[model samples]
Target chain A: MSDVTGGGSGADDAADSDDAAGADFDGAQRTGDVPTLSATDVEAGYDQHQVLHGITFESRDGVTCIFGPNGSGKSTFLKTMNGIVPVWDGTITYGDVDLTDEKPEDIVTHGIATLPQGGGIFASLSVEENLNVGAFTVDDADAIAERKAEVLEVFPALEDKLDQKARELSGGQQMMVSLGRAMMTGADTFLLDEPSAGLAPRLVDDAFGLIERLVDRGAQVILIEQNVRAALRLADYVYILAEGEVQFHGPPEDLSEEDELMELYLGL
Target chain B: MVDIGLFTQIVINGLLLGGIYVTIGVGFSLAFGVLEVVDFAVGEYVMVGAFMGAVLAPLFGAEGVFVIPIVLVVFFAVGALIQPLIHHVTTGDRPHPLLMGLVFTFGLATFLRGSVLTIFGPNSQDVPSSLLTGGIEVPGLGTFPVVRTVTAVFGVTGLAVFMYYLYRTRGGMAIRAIAEDRTNARLMGININRYQSIAYGAYAALTGSAGVFIGMTFNASPGMGLQYTAFAFFMVVLAGMGYLPGVIVAGIVLGLTQSFTAVYISGNAVLLVLFAIIYVVLLVSPAGILGKGEWAT
Candidate 1:
């Protein structure tokens, strides 16, 4: 497991001790410091057609926003994080192990959880049953019970809707369940693809708020968003992708005045 | 003029026969629901169970009553082991589940039949002294064979136990979730491979039980697999795959239809009529009576 957040800020210093002793793939050892995931010059694509060209980035202890227009490979980039889509080149290191060729199950071992773009919840399963599945990797009954309580507390709406079939939930609520289910894995890092996609403005705000709160709890978030302005507001670091390549990589403050970014990337 | 007593006996026999039909169809239904895999080789499993019962029957002296439990356990184990092979092929990302599972299981069925022939020889075998020794007269409805009554008991008990296992247990819920949406279930941490294997294993066991039931009532032969295979498929299609209760009802209905036809028409003609009814039912309700979702193309 490669330490994704190892090189970020000063957080890595405090995480160093815990990473030395704790399971390499368990939740973050040091809440606000240790790096959770890192991708270095990663080249990934679909069926021999490359989509991400030499993508390099890192997420440490807070939300790292990825905003790009359509066909910029945002979803593809997210898939590579979990090895759902293989990396053709470069290395993706989670915690201390290299994940360039690891299976998706192995990726989960590194304490990184993913909630893919849309319709990720099991349609036929009742809401609570879906939540139970999130704890599948956890074998202990007590631990599963504790995690379920924790998840329901975070998303209290799910408590009342436990028996309802998941497909019956509103799109926004479904997204919450998807994220909450990922949280059940006790993963330190989250790979969220367009959490705001197809959501109403109010629901988008709710989704963004949830991401902010997760980051506040010392969880690392790698977010792929089409809502560029809203994402920048919540992100600590930003990467602008264009046609499978990184157009800009810096703090949000640096790109605040770039008129060309708004015209070409944001289309404002 | 028909003998009312004989008619009564035939009806009772048909009901007992339907019980076995339901067991066979239930296994087929679960296999399709979980893996979208059609188990053409299911009949072979039943054949194996029947032969195993026949072999065990003789060991228990002249009466095979003691061999019943032994056969169930042995056949259940056999089903569990054979399930992995079926899963191995159907696990691939292919759309033609029926074609793949059907063709592969067919090959397996042939191999099993050949093996049975080699071991048991090409001969029909049965339990010694008959599992049912005598019949008791009903006040108004003629005498019913004690063994046939026991067969019905086994059938209904099997269905009851299967239903309880599927709906009441934690593992059962997991299986239902997988059957509904495999990809989402996997994301939620449902080990697709583990649950699927168990489902297949259970299917095998169910088929085995049905086989043993059939063997005790009728003669066990390698060729018998074909008839049961066709009947099970018909029952599944008629009852709808995945709906266990519906399959049971369909099995009984099929049994009654066959019995009534056998009384008035040729045995071969009975099959034709049954298939004709099945076709009409499918035309009206494509998913079978209580199938999942709306009708299909």
Candidate 2:
């Protein structure tokens, strides 16, 4: 794990710097030009029930994985960032944009795109139509066409199914369409929630591979995952969330050394 | 003692009338399918359209040929204006979307009906018939009225244009996407309010156009709104919600049934049989004839 972080290619570091710089909205002094997504005292919940209890964290570049047991406010945290769930208190800042109280559609325009757990793709729409819808904000037809080609290049399996409806695709393929749709926005930051929730073990790796590609392409990704092993493998920074609060935040190798973290929280 | 020639003519008449029903019903289907709003005031738009055509006929002359475009624009504007308010009421933190839609649209229908009553009074008014007063005689079949033929032609043209717009245009695709999954559509950055307004406006225009055709054939009365509304509802139910092609087929079928029943049986039995058909169709396939599977592609 140390070797993976240490042997990071120059391109990877450059991309990280670019994304980190993009996320530096506060104009705060930093030791390095690291792009970061910061949340301070974020208090939010769904109608009469409070879930997140003033949790705070700063995610810098690369893959920031948030993992927890069921009902640990992981999904809620992602939802709050995506603007699906209203933020009752606290602030969320990404790059030069203050994302607190922003509409979900507006959030996408700010280079932050979100993918929910399931049913993200328009089922009745064709693959081409889905891609078109993904680029709703992009008025230039040529740009949409170019972006679509780029997205399809990443998900080659969908190339042949452009005219096919999204509902007709396999479960893994549907997930791909969802991710591809988010990518079509050309967003710098991606908030993915339980991307591999119902995928087979084989498809799980494929999904992670796509995330790694996004990270490699200079996009900052904050992911919530149930598959701890796969998530830790790809994540640059890991946050262990339990009971609506952060219990651990460090590199994957550091978390692996703590035996209690493995048994108590992770059930490993 | 039923004349076969007369029976043939009745069938032809029914088919033409079905064309008018299709035009009116398509709007209702569109509203139900995409917006998921059962617009109870759909019939009121038809009444308003007929009234507008009647009022404009004398001024425009040429048997209100010019009134069609004017009525379409007016109805479209009215629809666009009212849609946002309806959308807010139906979608605002409501427990049941369908119930909210029903209540809101029902209220709208009542209000519109009252307005028309106050303005037009209870008396039925006639539209100018100078444009399509003649009939074309067929070789084997009986003479077909120029009015029914012209109205049927216009109806078909309207349906074709609407279908083309829905299947071909980017706006149409967005509308279909919303109908499929609204949340996902919003996630894709498709503006829900704007699209809803556009769709409702188009629907109103189509229904209003049907009203012009209806006014030329029959009396334009404030009370006549409910009958067209019933026809549209019956047709939509028969076709299945959100299925465009099915609405067309159902409209024609219902029209034929009404025409044939009115001729052979009794005029009163037209609605009774139509309702019975709707009941049976629902029991057999709750999703309608098209099975509510895909948007009318």
Candidate 3:
């Protein structure tokens, strides 16, 4: 290990491809090297039936990738991160803050932006409009313009499609816009659910490249993806989930290679 | 098969009547568009505005023309408040908001109507008008009611302003975008609840204006809501809920059809014949003549 789980100065860390875990928090207050995200015995469900039964997990820093089959409560877990789903028996805390009870809108203001699975762009709105709308927390007009320009720089494909309706774009382009929309908020943590879903093989590669760029830019990425091999290669740490429980959590190298982990969960 | 002047009168009246229909239809459509539920009590809300105008016109010495803004402001608040309450009561994991909204608003409507009956009495109250009394004389055509002409102008102007706000203003764009796709809009940080309130407010303004016109043209009574409710509902679904321009046309066509039917057929048979024509039209164009299918999607 390259100490990918640490936090540091964030300047040089952002410049370098290394984890630079301590560098992300080197400024004034020494609030520990790794950021804390905890779900303490959470039981979430619909009206009557509980889908998530007392689930608990903790992530220090860097990308914490969650892998599971379709019905293993993966989407529900992601929704709970931003308070989309109510916690039945557990609490989610970021540092000292109790985020388990906050509203979804309030969660976004706290630097946690959720890029929901599928193309979450406003289908009828233009690409520029969609991106601008995403900057809902940014109040100052000048700041909004600056962020819009900056995001466009990061994703050049969105630049030319500014005036085009989001629904008119291809699935991959829509995903790019979705990322651009989320990037507008300057979120420190990303709760991405299956960014590669429904994307063609070529677009998936491009989208993965974009994700790498995001991780390189000093944002902590939490990806919940089905593509086990790709996720293992990209993620510093991995958590394997089955039947609404965490069966394994550690460095990707610790897992018995890609095929072994697949056979354990997929029964292939 | 009738006098040319009478035919012309029917046509003009139909057009003017259509303007009022457009105003009411727009309110109904906007409420449904934003909230995914029809304010079934909207008919009563219109009645409330009409009664408000009826009561205030006598006190302020203001006619129908001036009472619009006051009625609009009052009803806008009413719309905003009522929408959230409906959302609170019936919004949690309900499959059919339309059905729940209808049931809830219908109860509200009944309560409002009973309140009006108890306070204002069953007898109809008159709303005096001065601004739209005289007719505008054209060269060949006979004089048209000044009120009817102005209402038509209000109809077109209201739609123009509404459409502009929906496309041009930041707030308006947010509303339409949210209406089209709520989850995506939420991801963009558009406050769903706030924009929904604004949409309800706009609905109130439209229906409030219709109420004012109703008061100016006819007497206000507890039963007035029922009279307009059926027609307003027909126009909304007939024009297709999402088609703004189509709603306007549908309103006008509905008015004209009613007027012509009343002229050629028996007064008692007018509604029956008009509804028949509407059913035929709906059958021919399931999405309403100019309406699109994407609105439902």
Candidate 4:
């Protein structure tokens, strides 16, 4: 379990970071340059039913994993940050700007991108088209082409499948497309919802590998995950939510010691 | 009945008419593909376009050709306004969005038809277009009416443009993303309402413009809409609902069948034969004639 997250590769991962993720996502540049995402007493929910009950948290520089059982408002909170679910009562701020009233489309322009579960893809669209859609915020064709080239370098397998429809790709490849597509936005921050939801068991590690690569590149990632073991391995900071409230939030090693709550919610 | 000249002429007529069907089907398929709405108002839009030509042509020196640009803008605006209403009724805890959209558009169709009948007084009106008159007589291939040939060109050209927009343009990709899943589209930072309106507006605009050409081909009558509505349905069903490429194939099938049945069998039996063909298609390939669309539920 210790091999999965922080303290394992702080020294060696940086060596591979530059070659693997690229200079645009240079880890050194992101360590302090990116703005902190702070959620203060955020409240939101679907129609007539409240889901998030004044949850407060902040995203760390690396991976911030939100772990919970079913119906724990993990996904809802993530939506609130990305501006998908409107903040019913409280405010969510990225760095200094209050994103409470912003729409998801507006939020991405501020350098925040989101990936829904099942690698939410345009099934009928080709891989190239999917990536192009991600660059909706960016108008410069040269910049788009450069980012596309960078994305292909990260996931070389998708190079040949640029013209192939997304639905035709395997589950693992679709996940790559989702991640690669998000990269096209040139966003500094990411909100990923259940990235490993529908993957085959062997492919789960590969999905986590992609996330680790994102972290290595220095993009701040806020992930909602059910795969506790894999997520904890990548998490620099962890939060456990039972209902809508944050039960515990601290370092990964600290949460592992709370046996009772771990068993009740995470089955860890 | 089997004279070579007559057969070739019928074939030419069928192909040309099929081109017009393609124009209507392209828009109808786009509506279904992007909005997930099986709009019943499709034919009414065409009828209204034809009527616009009828009403506005004389003002512009009686050329329906000049009415195209005006109809495009008007229908696009109307479609954009109506799309949000469709979105409102169909989304958020509304079960059976497909049904809701169908019913809404059906009501819209009725409203459009009734309004035209009321305003025009149930009479056939000519959309005079001197620019698209007569035929190009070929020594061996027979005469091809400039009007039908031009309409076919418009249909095919419209389909080509739509294909380019859908397959190559970034805006087209955004609409496709929304069609796949709205929630995901939002997560990708796509403005769902904006793109949907663009898609519906384009559909309405193209469909309406096709009406002007159709008006030039046939007189603009209040009841002419129902025939188009039926043909549009046949077009989508045969095109495999929402499948753009299949629209051309479906149009050909419809055009040839209508021409042959009207000429060889009985002019009256065309409707009956069309219905029978549709019934068989539904039974055998509910997905579509090309086996590549959402299955009829």
**Residue-level lDDT tens digits of model 2 in B171-279:** 9888888887776677677777788889889989989988888899876999988888899889888887777778888988987999899988899898899999999
True contacts kept of 2: 0.58
**Taking the tens digit of each residue's C-alpha lDDT, what string does model 4 give over B87-159?**
8878777989889999999999999999999998999999887788889998888779999998899888887
Q: Write the per-residue lDDT of candidate 4 for residues A10-49, one digit (tens) a residue.
A: 4645665544344353222445556788899988899989
Every model's DockQ, to 2 decimals?
0.32, 0.51, 0.43, 0.60
Give the DockQ of candidate 4: 0.60
lDDT sort, best first: 4, 2, 1, 3
Candidate 2 CAPRI grade: medium
Kindly list the per-residue Cα lDDT of model 1 for residues A1-268, writing each as its tens digit: 2234341224454665555343222333447654457889988887657899999888855778888889998788888888678788999987677878876755764567787777477766778877776766655565466567767877888999999998899887897788777877766788888878778788888899988777765688998988887887888888888888889978878788787986898785
RMSD of each: 5.8, 6.3, 5.5, 5.4
State the displacement of the C-alpha of residue A124, model 2, in Å, after optimal TM-score superposition.
Answer: 1.5
lDDT of 1 at A152: 80
TM-score of 4: 0.92
| TM-score of chain B taken alone, every candidate | 0.91, 0.94, 0.92, 0.95
Compared with the true structure, what per-residue lDDT tens digits does model 2 show for residues A1-268?
0011211223454544543343221111222333456888898887788999988988767889998899989889887887778899999877656889887767776666778777388887888888777777765554456567678777889999999999899988888788788876656677888888878878888888988877766677899988898888888888888888889999888998988987888888
User: What shift in Å separates residue A110 of candidate 2 from its native position after superposition?
Assistant: 2.1
Model 2, TM vs. native = 0.88
Chain A TM-score, each candidate: 0.86, 0.85, 0.84, 0.89
Q: Which candidate is the best by lDDT?
A: 4
What order do candidates take by DockQ, descending?
Answer: 4, 2, 3, 1
In model 1, the runs with Cα more than 4 Å from the true position are: A1-35, A41-54, A67-73, A86-90, A97-102, A196-202, A226-233, A240-248, A253-268, B1-11, B59-88, B91-98, B118-122, B136-144, B291-297
Q: Residue B72 CA error for candidate 2 (Å)?
A: 2.0
Point out the higher-scoring one by TM-score: 2 or 4. Answer: 4
lDDT of 1: 0.75
Q: How far is candidate 3 from the true structure (C-alpha RMSD, Å)?
A: 5.5
